[model samples]
Target: MTLPRLFAIAILSLTPGLTAHAGGKKGENSGISFHLQGDPSDNPKMIFEQNTAGKQVVYRRNPDFMTKDVAAFNSFPSQDGQGFGVVLQLKPSAKNRLAALTSANIDRWMLAMVNGRKVDAVIIDKQVEDGYLVIWKGIGQAEIDAFDTQVPRIGEKKPRR
Candidate 1:
């Protein structure tokens, strides 16, 4: 085999590893965000998307809330034992906005997306009076780690070191 051909093969093999490493860095795509269902009506702010079940869902182009709005969080084992469930406490401003959004959009779907993937969806049955939002399941360790880095866990103290 020619030297140049061997060098090309080596570089190609390393490309995937390098790309994966870069993507794994904190604050890149690791944070969580929420999007609300949009109406079928064509609006510039809304976009069409398909959920994990392949059902067509319409949602706003921007998220209703993101990691920045989180004041703290709590994680627990899912009822079905599949993965962890997380409860996110939003900041005051985001809390009011979420309450209004949920109250106004009752019966619509609210999606929880992590690492740019739609992880779970819930129907807005009632208005959220408190600032908390729950992602029922499908959270993995990587996501938990990302959340730890981005937001503090509820009642956790700062490290003395």
Candidate 2:
């Protein structure tokens, strides 16, 4: 009946092998939001509006540059070879868009979401060369794994409940 409910239903209808998980405390909203950036009605760019714990969060993706699709995900050591980070391998088409992003867009914020939750608001510092979108700061293995698992789950076909 609410936007969140409608969103959950819509997601359920679209995804395959989706199941309603119970066992949590009753009346608690345990639904997770998983969506890409950008509004399909207005812009094809990466931007998404998500609801988390009854709060509305808007994720604004770069207008000039957006990932076409995630090709793969990998965990690697940081660029300085210290600590660790996640690398998002984007589709080939994303390479063209990445070319438009230069050092000027550095420090600009971009959203990296997982299951409809705002996981990381990454700020770019160097050029997003090639199709590898490296996220080192303000990210952990959990968020990376979520994105890795959930992105491919969009637009799937599940049996009617």
Candidate 3:
């Protein structure tokens, strides 16, 4: 299969109750989703062909990761001053999702989404013993802020937009 199709399959498999909008309904709300993409050891490339609003875009996926338990989001200044970072805290019930990952998946990219819009992607460099995930790459402060504002609370349904 082509890369995009395979990528879609991988994403679909990871996120339950979520469907890709590439050809489906124009605006399906896929609240807070994650997927792994490509080999962790390969060079990463930005997905220019999927651009929108003239902004460069990249696709990410995590084939083995899945969850619907994002408890909260907060932003903090990057230590080196390059930019800001967003931290995702998973609920207690969802902590196992992080534990499921192993060193074999280290360096793999974790694709994050809010309401079906690709928000951010982070490379998995180590096992997450704690439920706190610091996403410091593949997104800017603006995107992080938007995510904080747009994401629905746990057990809340996303409104149609």
Which numbered prediction scores highest in lDDT against the true structure? Answer: 1
* Per-candidate clashes, comma-separated: 0, 7, 5
lDDT (0 to 1) per candidate: 0.82, 0.50, 0.56
lDDT, candidate 3, equals 0.56
Residue lDDT tens for model 1, 1-161: 99999998899797866755664553355478898988778585466575645678888757899988988898999888988999998899999999899999998988898877777889899999899999999899777876787677877653111
The numbered model that scores best in TM-score is 1
Q: For residues 27-65, could you state the per-residue lDDT of candidate 2 as single tens digits?
A: 232212213233336453455565533545444443333
* Model 2, runs deviating above 4 Å: 1-68, 76-85, 102-104, 137-161
> Model 2: C-alpha RMSD to truth?
12.5
What does candidate 3's lDDT look like per residue over 104-133, in tens digits? 568666666555555556667888878766
Residue 55 in model 1: lDDT: 78
Ranking by TM-score: 1, 3, 2
How does each model score on TM-score?
Answer: 0.74, 0.40, 0.46
Off by over 4 Å in 1: 1-28, 52-54, 157-161
Candidate 1 colliding pairs? none
Better of 1 and 2 by lDDT: 1
Worst 10 residues of 1 by lDDT: 21-30
